[model samples]
Target: MIKYFVMGLRGFFLLAAKIWSFVCYCFKRQARTVIQHQTVRYEVIQLSPLSKHRLSMLKRKTLVLDLDETLIHSHHDGVLKPTVKPGTPPDFVLKVNIDRHPVRFFVHKRPHVDYFLEIVSQWYDLVVFTASMEIYGAAVADKLDNNKGILRRRYYRQHCHLAEGSYTKDLCDICSDLSSIFILDNSPVAYRNYQDNAIPIRSWFSDPTDTALLCLLPMLDALRFCNDVRSVLSRNLHLHRT
Candidate 1:
């Protein structure tokens, strides 16, 4: 009777093992079927624009701006700005003492300059490197900044290297990091020292309908992402100047 009982117990264990194996096999087969019929889909999601505080988190490139002819056109009392209207007032007047003589200048801002500065300031740390005198550049810079404090720094004529009777900007004096620095000037000679980093803008001389500054937005926007500005400014600017 004891031997028969042991045989029955062995049979019962075998049957339970078979049932467990069958259950596992069914589960695996069902999973395989589900995977085979699985449908994959992709969707693009749009995000909101970054805030000024958020923009600060990003490592920005340095953009050096030229003062005269590039951003604004200023003429002294001795020379008449041919484009100026008979009765139209200048944007602002600047008077500075030079050589023991006080000189007055009529200043006109380039079209869309305010909007351009507002946008670029968000992407780059703007710096003014003008060939103009310190007293004059500082006053104009103040007008451009308009208390927004967007311009990070300023470099004047004294800071420039005198070359061939012309003042050319040395970007190294402003920022030594060549890879991330850009010089936006109307004059080629100003950026002759750093051709790779130069962004040649048209000479602005009181053209109200001028869209040059606006056209540069797309290029400037695209450049902030690059590790080296020369990689794109040198190659892609020709393709997308429109």
Candidate 2:
């Protein structure tokens, strides 16, 4: 009887030790998270424009962008459609003989795209990600080369899987790091996958004129702010190697 009682006591002690160890581990993890969250939050608040004369600097080194329907409008029909409000240019169609079949075409460029991209290029490293086949994406890249600069790389549809009109989780898995990375796209569905690090722009198909710059400006400003804060933190923390 005494032996059985001693074994029961040992078992209880072992179980209690495990529970204590788990609780300590959990508390330590939570404390670390709280510290990180507070640090970031405090830095952000302190860097408010009104509170400081200089903007926070960031170490952002990469900028990824979407090609089709984002940088420029390209439809499967191969027509240049224009985006205009009512009382603007009415829709028209043109016929082209392809394999002896007459095909209609309609499309146009977004306004201000040239100016917006020109300014944005000066600020960040740009890469294009597109779900379109490489052949088609390359053609669009060639056309935008003048304004957006040479696309460093193009990610095609093959890089991601399609399911029910949406790409699988592989897209986000590919761009896991949010540090200094931004994706600009018009498709809300596609952008949803990377909303945490991506900027979603509205489709400007009907009015091909460049109006997106106005909306994009605020986000750029916010990015600049984040950059400034990151710079200060890095310096104070001695994060620079050189």
Tell me the whole-model lDDT of each prediction, alpha carbons only: 0.81, 0.56
Query: Per-prediction TM-score, please?
Result: 0.72, 0.54
Candidate achieving the largest TM-score: 1
Candidate 1 residues lying further than 4 Å off, grouped into runs, are 1-58, 80-85, 236-242
Model 2 Cα shift for residue 66 (angstroms): 1.8
Candidate 1, residues 63-176: lDDT per residue as tens digits?
Answer: 999988889988887775455666667899999888989999889998778888888896789999999899899989999999999975999999988989999888888778
- For candidate 1, the per-residue lDDT at 223 reads 78
The candidate that wins on lDDT is 1
Cα distance off (Å), candidate 2, residue 47: 16
